[model samples]
Target: MKWKVVVMLGAALTLFGCSKPDAEPTESELSNHQSQQVVIVHGLGRSAWSMQTMSDLISKQGYQVCVVDYPTLRQSIDNTLGESASAISNCLSQFEEADFVHTNQSKTHFVGHSLGGLVIRSYLANHPDFVSSKEMGEVVFLGTPNHGSDVADYFVNNGLLSLLGETATSLTTDPNSFPNSLPQPNYEFGVIAGTQSYPVFSGMFDNSNDGLVSVESTKLEGMKDFVEVDIKHDKLRRDPYVTRLILSFISTGTFDAS
Candidate 1:
C-alpha cells in the first residue's frame, strides 16, 4: 500500500508538475563556462520537466545545461537508450556550432538523477565513439541505484512491476538487472546518496536510504568521490546543498566543500 502511494504520488507529480527551466546563462556567466556544458537527465517515469530545477541551478553556475527527455514510463532501458543518446548528441552539437568544441576545446559533463544516471552510463558504454574520457568532464549521480534496487525487486515478485514497464524489471536487485550489468565508469565521476527517507518506508531498507533507493545501492566501484546528503529520493535533484556539491564536484574532482 505504501509503495502504491509513492508510485501514485510520483505519477501525479510527473503529470501535473509546473516545472519550467530557467533562462540561459547570462553573458557574464557564459564568459566563464563558454567551453563547458552539462546535460541533466531525470529519473524513471519523469520527464525533462522534473529536472528544471537542476538545469536552472547549474546554468547559474555558468554551464550550458540540457535536460534530456526520454520515454521512461514503460520502456526497457535498452529501448530508451538511443533516444537518450540522440538528445545528448543534439545538445553537444551546439558547442560544435559555436566553435567552443574545436577552438576552445569544450568539455561536456553529466548530471543524472536515479534512472538518469544509468541512462548516462549505458549511453557512454554503448556509444564509445561519441566522446572519449579526456573530452568527458566529471559525472555526478544523485541517488542512482548503481547496484540495483530492492524496491524494484519487491514490485517484480508481486507481478506489479509490469504496470511500470520493462525498466522496472530491469532495475531489480538481481545481479543481472540492467543497473547491475553496466560496467563501472572509466571516467571521472562521483556518487551522492541520500540519507533521509520516508518513515513509512525506512524499515524496508537495511541501510540509510532516500525512500526509493538505499545508500548502498547508489555506490559503484572506482568512483572518484562519494558523499551523502540529507534529502529524500524525490528531492535530491532540487536540494540546494546537494546542488552545491554537484557544482563542487564538477569544478573540482572532489565533493569536498569549497
Candidate 2:
C-alpha cells in the first residue's frame, strides 16, 4: 500500500505520495487489516454532496466513508450537533452490528468543513464519551471558524442579511457566542486554512482570511498541527492538495507543517 504525504511550502500546500501501490488485496487478504471509518460533515448552506468527493477518495483507500447532511442554513449549531452525532454513530454502528469488521480496535475519524467543523466541536462537547468508546482518531477542520467569523458579524449587522436566518447570524465571533463557549479539542486534530480570500467578503476580515474565516479564526487552542493552503474557504474540501492533506493526517496522525 502507498502512503501519501502532505507538505507545506512557502504560501502553499503540496501533496506527494511516498510509495507505490502494490497488488490489490482480496477480502481475505484484508481481513486482518485495521478497520477504519471516516465521517464527513458538510458546511453551512451545503449538503452531503459537497463532501462526496472527499468521501469517495477515502473509500478508495479501503476505509468506510459516511457523508452527513443537515439543515445548516436554518438550524443553529446547538440544534444540529445531536443530529450530526447520531448520524455519525449510525454510520459507525453498521460495522459493529454486522460483525463484518473487527471492532476490538476499530477507529473512527471526523472531518468537517467550515461551519461543519463547529458542528463537530459542539457534538464532542455534548457527547465527550463518544471519543473513547469509538476509538476516536484525529479530526481535520478545513476553513472552519474555531474562534468565530467576522463576516458573520458583518452579515448579522446588516438587517437585510438577517433574512438568511439563525445559521447566518450564529457564526459571529461575539464575546458570548456558541463558538466562544466550546472547549478546545481533546482528541488529536489539525486545522487547514486558506490564504486566499474571496474578493467580495475580503473587506470583512481585519487580518488574512479565507473569504469568510480568518486564518486566526480557524485556529484552536491545542491544535496538533496547522497549515495554510492557497485554496479558498468553500473550495477547501474539494481541492486536491487539501483533500490529500486530510488523507495524510488521518493515516499518520500528522501532516507536514511550517
Candidate 3:
C-alpha cells in the first residue's frame, strides 16, 4: 500500500510540468581557465535542476561544468543520448575556440544520475570513436540502474510504466529492455549506490535499495570502484558527501578519498 502511494505520487509529480527544457547552468563561465571539463546529466523525469548542487560544487573546484537538460518525460532515450552528446561536444568546442592551451589534451569526465548514466553509456557505445578521440576520463554513476530496476518492473507489470514515457519502460528489469541491452562501459568508471529504503515499503525489493534502484542494480562488471551510501534515491546527487565521492572518483578513479 505504501509503495503504491509513492509510485502514484511520483507519477503525479512527473506530469505537473510541460515537456520543455528548464533553464539551467548549462556551462559555467570559463573564468578559471580550467582545462578539465565535467558534464552532468540528470535522471528520469527530472530536469538539469536535479543536478544543480553537484554542478555548483564541481564548478567551485575549478572544473568547467556542463549540465545537460533533457525532457525525460517527453522523449525517447535515444534522442536524449544524442542531444547529450551534442551538448558535450558544443561545450568542449568552446575551449578550442578560446584557444585554451593544450585544449586537445584536456580530459573530459562524465557524471550521470539514473537514466542519465545510461545516456552516457549509450553515447559511448554508439560512438566508439569518442573513447579514443576525446581522451575521455573517468565516469561516475549515481544510483544508476545498470541492471535495470524492480520499481520499473513493477510499473511495467501493472501496465503503468508508460505514464513516465518510454524511458521509464526502458528501465524495466527485462533482459531485452533498452537499458539492460546496452553494453557495459569499456572506460574507467565508478558506481555510487544509496541503501536507505523507505521502511514502510522496504518489502517492495528483495534486497537493499534507495527507494527506486536496488544496490545490485547499480553495479557493472568493469567499474573501477563502487561505493554505498545511506541515502535515498532522489538525494544521492544532492548530498555533500556524495558530491565529494564524485569528485574523488573523477580525480583519482576511486571513491576511497571521499
Candidate 4:
C-alpha cells in the first residue's frame, strides 16, 4: 500500500510539471517580440528628413526608426562611407538606449534610397565588422543606380554633377569603382525600380527609365526580389505602393509586384 501511494505521488508530480504553462512574456520581450530597428538613408542631395514618412509608417508597426543625415554632395564615396558608418553606429547606440529604457535589445534593418542605397552597399561590403552575415536581417533599395546612371553623364557635362562630387563619376563614367564597391548578393536584398518617366527628361533614357536610371540597370545580380512602380523617379520615394512593397519584403524575404 505504501509503495503504491509513493508511485502515485511521483506520477502526479510528473503530470503537474508537464502541464504547467510557460510564464507570460516580460514587458521587454513583448515590446521586442516582433520589433526591429530600421535605419533609413536618403539619396544624393536629399536629407534624412526625406525618409520621414516611411520611418513613421514603420514605427507605427512597433519598430524604432532612424533616418541618417549626411553631407551627400560634399564628399567622395570613401568619405561618405565613413560618415554613413558613423551614422549607423550612432543608430545602434540609440538601440542601446532603448535597451536601458525599455529593456529590449533588438536587431537593426537598413533601407536606403538611390545613392544612399549605394552608400549602404559600399559600407556593408567594406566594413564587415559593423554588420555580420548573421546580424543583417534585410536590405532594401529604392531606385538605386546599381549599374550607374546616364543622367549622371548628362549632369557631368552640364556642370551640375560637381555637387555630387566623385559619386556622380563613380556611378556613371567610372564603372569599375562603384560596381566593385558593392558586395555580391551573399545576403537577402530587395530592389525597387521606377517605370514612369517625367515628360521633360523622356528623351534622356535609351528606353524605359525613371529619368535617371533604367529599369534594366536596377536589376542587380544578388537581389532576392525585384519590383517596378509606375511612379516617376523623384516621386518613387514617396509612393505608398513602394512603401507597402518594402514593408512586405522586410517582413517576408519575398515581394510581389502586384
- Of the candidates shown, which would achieve the greatest TM-score relative to the real structure? 1
> What residue runs in model 2 are displaced by over 4 Å at the alpha carbon?
1-34
In angstroms, give how far residue 53 of model 2 lies from its true place: 1.0
lDDT of each: 0.78, 0.71, 0.76, 0.68
Question: If scored against the real structure, what TM-score would every candidate get?
Answer: 0.86, 0.83, 0.85, 0.79
The C-alpha stretches of model 1 lying farther than 4 A from their native spots are: 1-30, 99-105, 130-133
Worst 10 residues of 2 by lDDT: 8-17
**152, model 4: CA deviation in Å?**
0.1
- Over 1-258, each residue of candidate 2 has an lDDT whose tens digit, in order, gives 011111111011111002223234468524433377788988877788878777876776667677888775456555666677787667767755654656565778889898778888878777778766757878998888888887767656654335555765677799777778788888889989988886656667779988778999999888888888887786788776677778778867676421
Residue 193 in model 1: shift from native, Å? 0.3
What lDDT is obtained when candidate 3 is compared to the true structure? 0.76
Over 161-199, each residue of candidate 4 has an lDDT whose tens digit, in order, gives 565477545666345758545667556799988888755
Question: Which rank order by TM-score, best down to worst?
Answer: 1, 3, 2, 4
lDDT of 2 at 166: 70
lDDT string for model 3 (179-231, tens) is 78999788899999999876544666999898888999999998899999988
Quantify how close model 3 is to the true structure by its C-alpha RMSD in Å.
6.4
Best by lDDT: 1
- What TM-score does prediction 2 earn? 0.83
The residue-level lDDT of candidate 2 at 80 comes to 69
